[model samples]
Target: MTDLARDGTHPGAPPPGVTMSAPDVDTHCPYCALQCGMTLRATPQRVEVRSRQFPTNRGGLCQKGWTAAELLDHPDRLTTPLVRDPHTAQLRPATWDEALDRVARTITGLQTAYGPDSIAVFGGGGLTNEKAYALGKFARVTLRTRNIDYNGRFCMSSAAAAGNRAFGIDRGLPFPLADLAGADTLLLVGANVAETMPPLVRYLVEQKARGGNLIVIDPRVTATARQATLHLQPMPGTDLAVANALLHIAVTEGWVDKDYVETRTAGFDAVRRSVAGYWPAQVERLSGVPVADLETAARALGTAGTAIILTARGAEQHAKGVDTVTAFINLALALGLPGRPGSGYGCLTGQGNGQGGREHGQKADQLPGYRRIDDPAARAHVAGVWGVHPDDLPGPGLSAYELLDSIGSPTGPRALLVFGSNPVVSAPRAGRIQRRLGDLDLLVVADFVLSETAAMADVVLPTAQWAEEDGTMTNLEGRVLRRRALRPPPAGVRTDLSVIAELARRLVGDGMAGNGTTGGRTTGSATDGSGTTGGGAGSSFPEDPRLVFDELRRASAGGIADYAGVTWDRIDAEDGVFWPCPAEDRPGTPRLFAETFPTPDGRARFLPVEHRPAAEEVCPEYPLYLTTGRVLAQYQSGAQTRRIGPLRTAAPNAFLELHPDLASRLGVADGDEVTVHSRRGEMRAPARLSDTIRADTVFAPFHWGGAARANSLTNDALDPTSKMPEFKVCAVRVERA
Candidate 1:
């Protein structure tokens, strides 16, 4: 193995070398959703990234993005495919042929014994657009399975439910990040952007410079809250109460957008009546915010000429996540924030290409282009494009939580395939999910690292990382951009698409494609049923992304988005172009609802939401509220970044964040090992005492694994509507080790 030497770059170091050898090779930092544009300087032995001028971030990259290059060729990376002995739990390196054959046989056997519904596939938001799209299609058309979902269910399902109910669509933000700087007021409901997306948070600083009023609402004094003009530390699970009061004030004070509501909305009367009982006084009791503070926030949001509301996982990780998000939108509508300049509800996406992954049909209930699979018309449209019979398509299936539970049981799925996601670490009730995976008849996983999830797989296929793959991604604001591959994969690794193509052929026969070698290794039976002839003997399967995208374009015919003008040829000429560009004759819709909405009556709907209790309540046995979140140095689950030298050096291990006052009462001090136990599990980690959080609440970074895995202690109960797990509010007890 070759050991790559570092070029003296730290996680937070600035870019170096102004000029690059290849100009078109200019790319963006491959971390976080911020996606700071950068130019690459390639020397004979090393590569350096230099910040480039771009609209989103003014030549700035966070620690994770700046040090991404160091992770390109880590020594611990999985370089070959391995097939594990099911009975002995022993892994052996095998040719691609042997691995694919074993996987195909197991899937077929599982289908024959338990039916096609007994096979499932799990996807991730971090995968490139092309890879995510292909995985969804393969699960349905080739494998004929209804159980397909992604980690987004754990991350953004609440925000999606809110958008679909409020505005009849689910794009993150109507306006771009730059527009935030032009607003008169910006309300950050549940996000800590300064610590998460620091470069993008520059817009908020600029807005403050313009005399814009910034309001931050959270249970803690987060980094972003310290910079806000007003900070309201509401009690836990009480955001809905505060939001309803704001709406009550808007309606009573005649601040509601009467014309917009009367012209383009539904269910206003129900919402108005529901919020009537939530006056400032009553809400002040429900939430920790004072009556005066609630009134001040309402006035700032209502009287301001332009304002917007931004939410994050903090608001959507609760048991009532969907209801809380809807309340937020209702507050925005009462203040006339949507369908206008510099004002709307924006969800800061957690994954780099989460917006794109959802749009491309990787979600459980959705098809390509945000089309619902349950809708016959949408099914027909997509089926026609894929050249399959509508009757062949599967119906809506279980979400991630249900899917995980379904593994191994007779009535549950027996075969499971994973791509780019580590469920063993990210999924709630991690111990249960791990046991279920081990009990499966077959489990196949493709990743760059031997993640905790992959460690239990029956088959493990090494795949190329982001820097070794060429594709595209969609940003939080629905902007599409290119992902350029700057180097080649390690010795025996291959692209994800290649493995999927081979597996699809083995299961469904020649109908899938040819050779099954998509820029990867080739061995053994090419007879895994890949060819040009099947139902239609002479028809050829389109394997190249350029060809598949054309069919996708045709699938979106006549909808709000048209792919007629968006050809691979066109996209190749530049970085990339946003969709709904429609044609060469039209410009892309930068902001939605500028004139009208896509709702049935051309009006948004007001969802009457009520506050609900957390999944579990604090008791004598579990007396603390445990909240999970991320740090700037690591991504979710930390499969790749945590393995890198720079990232590991910054924050070496997980620590429990507790209030100093609470620690004092408990006889605990800084750096003292403590045991945190929940209803399902317990973990011991060093403590960090701080006043940033409430005395009754504790915080943990959800990126560590092993005995310290945070999700193991998280509650698995899901929101009835969105099927999102209760990751934020879990009851636990802490004591000295």
Candidate 2:
């Protein structure tokens, strides 16, 4: 955290006419994985934010970062807790005490009536690392329920799975973002960073100015694609085929780095055989991309001195997403990109803390430090840190979408607690998810604003905003950055860490018997009792994020994404620190895989993958493909961005983006209402005719709710490996509404 001045003055000086009572707090943006650095200063009337020098943004601020301060005091901010009156069955404002009591009582009653697994906890990727760690501990230590997971499962699971499969690790970006500026060739598959992260465009601009080849593969000529030297528009869900074709071309053209492949990688022969069948012409016929374009893209990547390949949500939200990403990794390996100084394959994580959020225990199958829940050694190490027996911890749970789908099932959780996420607006098959939430015996949601999910909660707890709390967030580059609070939270608003701690203490004190002990050792090393407690809960659940983080460092000491060497003071002093820092005296690793991979054999693996059709393919009944993504003005689900005046004004509602030819064929003009139908459900939005999109594909922003909810038309087919739902590609039909 940034230090505050004792005297009444700003960091350097107060603005010309404004007098400050304290120093401005230097912090990172509350949205996106870039985590742009900024300084928050207080004036007499309003708070102001200015860009700060940072590794990712380089002192550049996107529109979202410039206008983020407006959301601090939003009119719709939830100031106090709300509890549903059982008789009236309507939400009514209640004191924090009453709300907490009701929540604990309900959780206890539900567990006693059903089973310990009847209660579940749902977390979010936007949560700080400390909060995420604490919530995961609360579920395992207090509730002893295996039904815990977070929203990041929807964002980065497929990429993480593929990265781990091929490299024995997944850190989002193995290299820093600044490396993009120096690349000789950069290939972006299904990533539209231009709109989602405008500040990052400067690096692309730098690469272009240097005469580097910039290639983009997508179904639409998006803002980012328009900037590329070559754009290969493939049909949705065919990214794997495109990657395999590029590899096939590289092999046919004799562009493979045979020496590097022989020394630094394994299983290349299998991958080479797999790509042998994906001939350029055959792939051109399978996907919509042409043969010439495929050959051109392959040559650029193959011949470049330093090349990078990246995948994003567009390529990783299908039932075949893991295979698609693995295909890309196979190509990168064949090109000898991994473990190079400045070139590699990477994933563009979407949420603010998606990389860090998954590193901690909030993930369904993971423990802190990215440890597998089913691993005995990992369970023993984490349990020792929590002062519990390894046998006391529960096993793995369902993935995000599967957990939501099982909400009303006979064997699934009957009660749920949500923190920092509004799943109703974000989950695939959202309409059915909404009905599932309604079917839950208890639904508790925590947020600063009344989001679509919180609006229907049986209990709503107000949480502190980003600038009103102090914690840490790990950016896409695996750099740990501090989030400093400029001011205290509102009188009734609390932090999620505090809420989880208090709830765990309450459950422990009341002896939710079927579970393990919680209260005594909630904080790291608060008690000396090493093994599992017999029957009583401790009262030592700490609410301080710093204490929780201290515990996290110890829990993650020897694990994969180790944070033992990182400290708050070090982060502030060094700007930010990268992890797997095992000791405080050693500098953290900024660039990974320079010498060797982390696998047992010390070599990157080449996983042979084959392309498959999307789970829901377009047929005669639904003859068009539907895809969803973010808009420039709205962040994911628009839980916070929707409430900001400027952001909402820029993108007020969802729109149906289709090719001009498709609009003309449907007899619909721009601004005319159109209905999109799929096997799951339908959504209505205004037509946004443009020649940028392919004639066979339609696009929609997934940031809106109500009749314009795009996720309603998405498929819920899960990827067998990653458990990621098919949110990007689905079969649909369009009509004038």
Candidate 3:
């Protein structure tokens, strides 16, 4: 490794023999959506992390952020490409040229045999904004396939869907996290912020100190629930009923803000009629929450001068996730919270770049700046930016789960390009998804380590890690921040941007051309690639992050998440800039919809919703309800965090958290091995008995793969609107193993 300054200046750039101390680079943590600011000092052996004052984390770093530097030089980090041999059926180290050529040839052959859609690309929520934008453009311009989607679909699609429908825009948070300090009440629905993002817990403490109330709703008595002034322990999958009952209580108690509702919102009459049947008693019977607690929670929210509702995966990872989120939005709207100064509705995004990943064109049905793919105007605007014909771009494709389920089928994709995600362990029904990957004719993966998903790939391309890359990430507040390169990548390793650009150049050389017209025109010779592709000769993907962001600004000019005004220099000069900053002179809008909503009528819409049972109901044979979540020591799938010695030792393996009564009934003591059997499969793990959880519900962290994978028992029932899988609740049977 070579010494470099925080401004990305190399020591060699100075006069010869001039000794320069390695300057600490100001960068953000590579963990969650919080994107906590940190300074990194690069030494010969390792990198050191120190907290930097930022609005999101405020000079704080979680355990994961503090230990993130260890991942850069982990013993198991991949340094070279690996290609599987057809004869030996084993992965062998290979040069970059050989590995990339093999991948390109395999994809081309599959396209020739099955069609362009036969090759699909799957992205991850943790990818930087530049990488996500490039991946989407690659899929449309190079592969010319409508089969591109990302892991964000499984994380926050439900919340995004509801927010788009209600507010005419989808941002995880319309206001900054600091606003929580001024709120009169904070209602957290199924979100364990204390354990998920520890720094955020301070806001709740500040609210309490200011004589405000805090409400937590979860099935278990999580760490966050312990600090709440009122905790409503509702049964899993019944959050809709609880929300409706709260609205019903507000209406009956005359707590609704008549002036705000009448002037700033619409469809309240229908929502009021819909919740008329969900009284306190009925809600208690359905959601297992006491009537007294429900009334108390409702009263606190209704009486507050300004209140905010925050939700997480626990509330949105269900078959009726969209409806559940919509119900929460309805309650916020009735109280006139959306555009209020100190109140609104927001979702806590889980992944590192989850907010930015979905804003670009990585999702199936969206273009850059969160534009709809099916809209002609949006297509024209983006196509012009890419120097391609509008008709050359493929229409909306299958979503994340649907694309995975289509593998190996007659009309499914035969080849897949996976970047930044480990679907083998993260996707629902892990056993089935593993088989689908095995059935693919060609599988290519670009990752820093040989993750569970990468181990199954035919060609694994080693890529640069976060500390070795320069990019941008949008935090939960829709604030775009910079990620500076702290050190050079290891020899033989490449950034994802470089790899994608090189591969696109090779594919374009094979005769694929961009559509030459300005209008819709389907080219011929799909196999020969002689016809015009969307971004044929005109497409030139720059490997530099700054250049990619410049093109991104043009593509996102007029869309909902406009970022034309955001520049790398501006991000580095300030803490961060919020999106919808469409002009260079604008300072960026930190808070949106202050006086009016984005709808045509400038009013928020309230949708009526009803409660539904879990996708997989408990039966006589499988009497226990199974729920999955994360632990503090590990991140999603533990692909990178698990490699660190300290973090791995802290959380050695997964375990089942069951109630004392349930464990005793099953004849299992603490640390006893138990077999959790579900309809799809079964997993064995040690059981730890605790009284924090409900007697009928058992919890397991979903950060491990193989024998301890929690997704093996998760249900894949999709929400009709958001297409989110039911990962929170399922039926299972527990027995002493």
Among these predictions, the greatest TM-score belongs to 2
Instruction: For each candidate in turn, give its C-alpha RMSD to the true structure in angstroms.
Output: 5.6, 5.1, 6.4
Q: Write the per-residue lDDT of candidate 1 for residues 476-512, one digit (tens) a residue.
A: 7777766777777778888887787677666656322
lDDT of 3 by residue, 102-213 (tens): 9877777777677778989999999999999999988887788899999999999999999999999989989999999888999999888766776677777789999999
Better of 1 and 2 by lDDT: 2
**For every model shown, what is its TM-score relative to the native structure?**
0.92, 0.95, 0.94
TM-score winner between 2 and 3, please give it.
Answer: 2
Model 3 CA lDDT for position 237: 90
Candidates in order have lDDT scores of: 0.76, 0.87, 0.87
Q: Which should have the higher lDDT, number 2 or number 3?
A: 2
Off by over 4 Å in 3: 1-23, 512-538
- In model 1, where do residues sit more than 4 Å from their true spots? 1-24, 86-88, 510-543, 559-564, 568-575
Q: What tens-digit string does per-residue lDDT give for candidate 2 at 1-737? A: 01121122222233233323333889999999999988899776677877777888887766677778888887898999999999999899999899999999888888888877898889999999999998888887778889999999999999999999899899999889998988899999999988877778788888999999999998999888988999999999999999999999999999999999999999999989999999988998999899999999999999999999999999999899999999999999999998787799999999999999999999989999999999999987887777666777889999999999898889988899999899999999999999999999999999999899999999999999999999999999999999999998889999888898778767877776243334333334423233432222334357888877877888888889999999999999998899989779999988888888989998999988898898988899999999999887789999888887767776888999999898888899999999999998999999999899999999999999999999999999999999999999999999999
What order do you get sorting by TM-score, best first? 2, 3, 1
Position 427, candidate 1: lDDT? 94
